[model samples]
Target chain A: MGTVSTVLSPPALRTGMALAGAGFRRWATYRQAMLAGAFTNTVFGFLRTSVMLAVAAGAGGVAAGYRGPQLATYVWVGQGLLAVVQLWGWTELSDRVRTGDVQSDLLRPVHPVLSYLAADLGRAAFALCSRFVLPMVVGLIAFDLYLPHRPATYPLFLLSMLFATVVSFGVRYLVNLTAFWLLDIRGVIMAWLLCSNALTGMYFPIAFLPGWAQAVLWYATPFPSILQAPVDVVVERGTAGHQATVLAVQGCWAAVMLAAAVVVQRRAERRLVVQGG
Target chain B: MADRPTTAAAYRALLGAQLRAQTQYRFSFALDTAASALITLLDVVSVLVLFRVTPALAGFSFTDSLLIAGLANAAFQLCDMCVGNIDTMREYIRTGRFDAVLLRPLRVLPQLVFGDFSPRRIGRAAQALVVLVVALSLADVTWTPARTVLVVIAPLSGAVIFGAVFVAGSTTAFWFVESGEFANAFTYGGRDFTIYPVGIYPGWFRAVFAYSLGFAFVAYFPGLALLGRPDPLGTPGFLPWCSPLVAVLAATAAALVWRVGVRHYRSTGS
Candidate 1:
């Protein structure tokens, strides 16, 4: 029993490491997309920020607890944060599976769930450098958005954002795994995109939303924690205790989703075996 | 001479082939259509949610915004259906499929137009029509002969503008066949641009749409005419009429550029 346990532990760790390594290599080849993504985000950020400023002005200097600089900070940072969090265009795993690439993945020694997590993490890391940091820096210099000047706040904000990354990736992976059942994923993705756009505080802040709607969105989806919470931490001078609690909740959700992925994968593998795939 | 059987017959042949090809994947084709309709419906729902929270967006009333959304969706989908193959030009060239297309006896543009037809995009068209019907019932659009004329031309002119953008994007494949990213600014970005009122954007962005890209025709200026909206930026009365002209210019520019790109493509064979 002891020898069996010892052998399994090493293989699990090795599988994780291999997944991460393979993920990083694949991401490295798509450097051009990373750069182009950054540029497109920058354009969109500017356009969105302009509209937000106008809306804020029309609302008589503060709509939903945000003055000019505060609103600018929200709009600009939300763009950057969303880049890292990526609430849009995350249809990778489902597409691969639908194209029958899941068969190749099943052949791997590592678990399929770990492989997806690793690839997402690797891609998120690349996106952070190319889309988030660079664009935020440009917005900082060009638009003078209010940024985290306090040292402690930055670290906490980073932690929340990292939590956001993990949770968002988990939700996306869970959604992708559904492709095992649903052949057409476009409807599902579109629904996610619309929901995330509204709830992630991308187009408008959650604070601006009605109380009932805000309460529902906060509990139903991980959207707020993924983008708004991290940016709000920066804007509110890191009074992020509640946000931290939310992140902790997000972590729990990620665990639940990961477990779900394992169950689904096992069932799917059995089905594949029966079907002679 | 202009109504020659060859031209009309060629168009029919191309469309027929496209229809037959789309019928090949029966299940996938149905799902694609259903999925697209659901997506557009979902987006409309989001807009409806926004309207619930605020009575208006950017001073436009609920019905007004709905009208713009409906009209824009119709215009975008119609043009998208017409020139949808442009987006796949790079793939065609990269896979050496363009060679087979070139070997065909029909005019290159006609064959290209006929080669790829997405029946599923009817999903978007159907959604747009639904929105238009709903918005018409909701909004009090007192129709005049002139207003009716403007409404009909609005979508036709919008199609021209979007088709021009499609042509421009396809032409770029001759130079940067593998790099389809830059083309997004013109196609996807342009569609988003048209969905919103011109007043929502800043002067520079507006200028790019008005003067540089000439994309204002697709929805904005024509929308003002349909909605009887005042010039948000204080433009002349004739400016609204500039939509049809701008569309023609954009289409002309795209054609000229495409000719040059095709010449380069034939010479370099890349």
Candidate 2:
């Protein structure tokens, strides 16, 4: 236990990096699966782009703040980020908790939340390189996409993506932690998956939603930061100052969600201890 | 041989057992039903948002598009209720549990279909039915007796078409255990593709889905016939009635593929 404290204090950074590297290597081994996934994403990208472009064309080249080319960019970029943020179909942590394997994870020296977050970052890193870049390249060839010329826009977009990954990981961790109380969290997770996919601007732009719904989503959920903010920065929808503001808000949400995850994990661990797990 | 039950009786018994097993977890089943229904609602809402922004899709009015989406949803859900379990065929094949299925007295495909008979999926079907009713009320088409019959039979034919796709996809598991995701591009992706008027898509896309995949026969052609609208892309006037034939042909092809796959599995023992 004394070694656990020492390991937590100074060398935690090293452990985190090692875990991330391991995660990257683990996912990279599924080369065939990755290619198939990339292909599927690209196919769906064309479907979505067709729909959006059709709507815009029907409306005489503008609908809900999007022109034909802008809508295409939104669709393809959203498809790319979908794999990067991984908004659904992850059940590893909750499955572990249900089967009592989470106890082993708790017994490890490192904090479980930090370990999962690090691993998720590595997965996100890999997805960005493979899944993310593939769709964007296809989009570039298939359609006219918006590219921001401002130098600051590129760095800010990257920062927004990093924050988006963090926010997504935090929300997923919190959802999985509900297993401490509910024996079967699958239903809850399913409901969450449906909501997040719609609300996270993956299915369509958040602005296309009704005004009241958009306002509620903007203020109440951290979903838009996951996809919309970064894509908006890349597309240069708003001014540079506005882009900075979006990044700042995204960063803040990520920090707050990560903090909430830590607090929830602590409470869950105490409950587990009380129950003699 | 004298004690053997009829095939119909065997199927009924299998479905009865499945219902009993499913009802044993009543609370979880209810939750899952609601969740499935809610997920289906998202697609409707997405379509609604699109229509809210634009008056028409390609040339179809909002109500017309709604009718297309609703009929497509109803058809897909009906097929999904009966055959969606094919999505898990790979797991059974991988664990060698499929051999037990093959050894049973009943036919393998019927048993597989009945084995996963889920009452919970009725929730999605029910929602689609409601959408269909709403679309029928809103769309300006005159509902003649012939048109009404077409509307009623459309979903059934659509179910057969989608079921054929599911069977074909699952049969691939015998050759490639990890083909589930690839199969999804056909079954699930096909459903997504049919929700819109096929004419709005690019030329190549329309060609593939309409001619190659036969998805056009699923909803688009039938929808035009029911609505009394001509095909904007100049398809034949008689094409709408070809949906049933296309569905039967697809199912026949799927049955042949399943036979080949089963033969291969027996020879390779994998």
Local distance difference test scores for all models = 0.70, 0.82
Please provide TM-scores, in order, for all candidate models, with all chains considered together: 0.83, 0.92
The sequence of per-residue lDDT tens digits that candidate 1 reaches over residues A1-277 is 4633643687776776666677667766766566666666776666666656655655666656666677778877777777577677777777777777778888886667776777677666766666688778877876757756666777777777777887777667766766776655655665566667767777677777778888877777677767777777777633456646665766665666677777787886664521235
User: How much of the real interface does each model capture, measured as fnat?
Assistant: 0.12, 0.41
- Candidate 2 lDDT tens digits, B30-117: 6666776788877667889898788888888888888888888888999988888888777788778888888998888878888878
Per-residue lDDT of candidate 1, residues B75-110 (tens digit): 788887778677788777667777777776666776
* Clashing pairs in model 1, backbone N/Cα/C closer than 3 A: none
What value does DockQ give for candidate 1? 0.28
Clashes of 1: 0
* Residue A135 alpha-carbon offset, candidate 2, angstroms: 2.4
Which stretches of model 1 miss by more than 4 angstroms? A1-18, A66-75, A81-101, A182-209, A223-234, A237-239, A273-277, B1-35, B41-66, B94-96, B106-116, B133-142, B266-270
